[model samples]
Target: MTPQYMNISYHDLLKATSGFSSENVIGTGGFGVVYKGIMAVEGIITSVAIKVLNLEQRGASRSFLSECETLRSVRHRNLIKVLSCCSSIDHRGNDFKAVVFEYMPNGSLEEWLHPKESMNSQPFESLSIMQRLNIAIDVAAALGYLHEHGPVPVVHCDLKPSNILLDNEMIAHVGDFGLARFLIRQANISSPSMTSASGIKGSIGYIPPEYGFGSQASTEGDIYSYGILLLETFTGVSPTDERFTDVSSLHSHVKMAFPSRVLDVVDSKMFLERQCPGTKTVCAPKSAHDCLVSVLQCGIQCSKESPRERGTMKQVVRELDSARMLLLR
Candidate 1:
């Protein structure tokens, strides 16, 4: 059943976002522009993020319906909260469509992963190992919910750091359903990477091998993307990083140096040394690299060339749980 979305006046959204001014802009993508807005809700003022469709965009219409369709059925704590959507004409009589979501205060995971250097910054900090571990698990849990617990299986065709949002508490929320696909023909919509002749099946580097060969979007495809996301999280390198060449990829780069030289590729921001809390003294309870190696291996396995060979999301959840256990121990 499609959840009834709130119908907001275009004028209200316009006023809330200050006419969607450049200053209120938060994020921009192929489908449309998102703006931070303040609105009255049930007699109280509420903060919201409004995603306005860029009708001029090629697939913006399809993307809008796809997002609305997918989000209506899926609900998870780690998934972004959807408040409502707007489908109407603006005061000027131009067609307008938008989706409203709960405001995320901390911005995106991309910002946290790769913060830009600033003149006033005292020092640069990277996500701690514990923090990354938690995020990894958070993503896995969200995937698990979508795949197994949802009314129908949903595949997050595009899974990348930027699509993951963080709240004030630093909890992860998986957003961006513009390219979502429901398995077994629940809905028919193509992902951003889908093309008649292999433009790209997903994001540039995260596309699964099978998707490039004209395969339909499947849970396995999502697993492949997840694997790449896991690798990127640890290495702090985008799958499309300049260092990667046609002959080598983020997967191969990690595989070749894993275990033997894991630290070489790990982001320096992520503190590798396992130390006792509240003290500067080294108190390594165990070899931190051992757990890291396990993570890398799981990532490699999930990104297998053959979809049949890839680990299921269930296995991913289990393995990540174990990895988190190791980190804690």
Candidate 2:
């Protein structure tokens, strides 16, 4: 069902965010800054995340329109919901534009994976094996819906840990649709169109190899990005780590130590937390070890250098669910 959009004004948003105060700033990105605000929804005042676009930046206005269009067309619990939009002039007489969304209180998956001292006020806690598994499934399901089940198949174009927000229950919600594309299906073929004419649409490291060679945005590209995100979540390492210099990409790095040596690169905190108490051996529980291996295998399969070799989001979701069941039993 389509959500009812609240008609808001520049003054209303200004009041909601305290004139876009520095204290309200929650996140910063290429196109704009996200501010936490409170706005009345159906007569109840609720917190929201407002993405204020930097109109001065090239392509920023276009991004705002693209995100609005894409969000209006798609609806999924795993995908971020757009509450309202503002496209009026600011008090300064300059153009103002923003997209209001449901605020994710738990923050982003990136914050949990790589916490910085200044990033969060609360004590840092590592995500458990179960939490990570669930998050992965949530994201894969979202992408699968976007790629296959939605009324209009949309290409997220940008899929990364930073873009994955966690709600109060830690359920993952994929955000940042500024680079999204609606694929035009012709028979069995998806139309070809570059996300950006001059450069790549997504962040470095998350972008698929085919995109670099001028391949158009496709579901396969999103799958490739998802694969990298899964690998990073397990390993607790960034794809752009300095060690990944030269021919060594995240996929290759994880591939080299896969299966038998998988434990070597796995997140130490996660492994230790799952390790049996007072145990001296390097091994984890047999079920857990098997589960980790299977999960990593999915990541490996999804992040293949060749798009054709990568698994679909549906396949990834199925494999992850199987791993989750293995851990449960």
Candidate 3:
């Protein structure tokens, strides 16, 4: 079914977000802040993620409209669905602007992989090997859809664990479309090899090397980011973690360790159920180990330094799907 668009009022947003209270805030971005909100339409209370523009900024209003235009034209299961938006004056006569999204109860993959002390009991233990594989597949599928099947091809620009949110059922959804860009066809002309002029828009460590050299942002750039995310998901460690310091970076470290079959670097949770009577080395089930190896290989392929050498999102999805099927079997 086609999505229906509607303009919501600021008062409605205040009610939904509980007056934009500090407690309702879930995340923050460069252009706006996200808050948890609820709205009752047709007698049903629906939870949402409300991203309100920072009105005080000089040019934030323009960016807000651009984001709304980009989001309103696209729809996919992996992308966050926009319930509605508000860009009007509030009761205090202050101008306001905000976008509403479906709420993701499980927070983000980042939080689950690297929980803070304040939220230590946040249920990462519930994710089995199969479940992680499923989430990875969902993310890859979403990227594939965006790159190949959207109304216009789009580059997610920022593909990180923190932007990948999981719902109550653990289904992964790629959020934070503020940095997304639509690809344009330019008469099949050859593009530059680098994109340094853009000046690094993505998170540190996840940014591709070519991006620093002035290579134009392409599907390949997103592939590189996805590769980093995949490795983080499996290792349960950030790419910039101390363990990766011995080597220059996570990519190089993984390449070096791949030859040694060093799968032990993967998440400790995988070995939880198989620890021996009194040993630190826990044996992973053969199926789980194989799945981990496959996932690592996919990450490596997607992260190849040469953009031309990287696998497309479609291929990544296929490989992840196969790994998931194997683990489930």
lDDT of each: 0.80, 0.89, 0.77
Which is the leading candidate under TM-score? 2
Better of 1 and 2 by TM-score: 2
lDDT of 1 by residue, 1-329 (tens): 56666668889899999988988787877889889899976567988889999999888888899888888899899999888888999988999999999888877767777666222122335787778878888898999898778997888888988888878777889998988877653335432222222222467888998887778777788899999999988888888878889899999999898777776677755664644477544333354566787788889898878988887888998998888788777
TM match of model 2 to true structure: 0.94
lDDT of 2 by residue, 290-311 (tens): 9999999999999998888996
Where is the poorest 10-residue window by lDDT in model 3?
191-200
User: Candidates ranked by lDDT, best first?
Assistant: 2, 1, 3
Comparing 1 with 2 on lDDT, the higher-scoring candidate is 2
Clashes of 1: 0
Error of 2 at 117 (Å): 7.2
lDDT of 3 by residue, 1-104 (tens): 45676557887888887889988888876777889888874457888888899888754675577567667877778777777778888788888888888899
C-alpha lDDT (0 to 100) for residue 286 of candidate 1: 52
TM-score ranking, high to low: 2, 3, 1
